[model samples]
Target: MTVTEAEGDTAAQAPMGSSSYSRFDTDWLSDATLALFATGGTSPLFATSSTVEVRYLGTQATREASLSFQGPALFDTRSGCNFATALVDEFCLIDSIGTARTLGDLATGTTLDFTLTAQPQPLGSPIDQRASAESFSSLASARWIDLGGGQYLLGFEEGNDASYNDMVFLVSGATATLPSPALPVPELPTGWLLAAGLAALAWRHHTRR
Candidate 1:
């Protein structure tokens, strides 16, 4: 495996260097996409970073969203400098047909294709051991949930936190990008990344204690 493709530790998952979205593709929130134009995509969100999960999907009666993050760097806000290690923004294409919103939650038939670009550390060293208060640029992620038979919502959240409650998301039925994305963010994992889109259906709701 190439140096970039290798998996790193967690602590760096959350912006604050916590352990949340640090699992492999099978993990709850650790989603990796290759770069589009970069000829090669980088694992921007790889390693010790924390990720969040919703105990309830868009199908959960739209009540208080059952969301939770188990580490630092977890975010939830409109905008602000994030615990992200890089200063790059991500891109995605919605393929359904709801409100044509930029980002939000996902519904049963709702689908979106997004990409991420990991900024390589100076010496490839793990970051945020202590999760310094050094606020850099803000990072964001969007998702679409399947609320049972054809129901959907698109959700987008900025900043990093450990709360997935009542956080508004997008409605589904919006025509989004294709599952087998023609382009990736960093430009790696051509086959596997595309597989991820197809496998997104396996995610089970995460209930926080």
Candidate 2:
């Protein structure tokens, strides 16, 4: 479950400044095979054609992974390391909605594997917290690799749960378009407040795709 995100199979490159970054525009048809699995629930994992942007912030020396799609809510709680930018090649945010929403750094092999962990909560509880339950349950595990040249290999188990663990799904696709890194990154809208948790998308419901 090791994923490598880098430029060719060479030394890693850092974004010269805040403006330098890499943008990937997804091609749906190339990945239309996403329908071969079941996706929907509290953690709706998707390999469909969505906008994915990755960039390195020179000031922080950390990379950002952004995924924006028009669909139902997928992620809820985000847990891992806090915002200090010290750890390398480890889980940072299971889900994020801020500028540094991605997992990985300026170095190679930073974007490793992704796992889905969840625990049931007692009803009528007024609070929702991460790891509150002593026995945390593992829902699924996936392996993703960055094949360079704006291409990626994502393999995961669909409908993975206590009942299903025998199915695995894999997908690959090249970006339809890329963005010029010379331009400055856009700013988030004013007052776009995020919850206290690490930045992950706050999605609204949509019709099944």
* TM-scores of the models, in the order given: 0.19, 0.23
lDDT of 1 by residue, 1-209 (tens): 10111122221112111322111112222222211111221112111111112211111011111222222221222122222312232211111111121222333232223221122223222432232222222123444443433233333332233222112232223333322333555766779888886666445323321
Q: For model 2, how does the per-residue alpha-carbon lDDT over 143-198 read when each residue is reduced to its tens digit?
A: 33344555443333322232111111122332323322356888775555444122
Candidate 2 Cα errors over 4 Å, as ranges: 1-32, 36-100, 121-140, 143-148, 153-209
**What lDDT does each candidate get?**
0.24, 0.26
Instruction: Find the candidate with the highest TM-score and give its number.
Output: 2
Identify the leading candidate in terms of lDDT. 2
- The collision pairs in model 2 are 65-102, 95-200, 96-199, 96-200, 97-199, 97-200
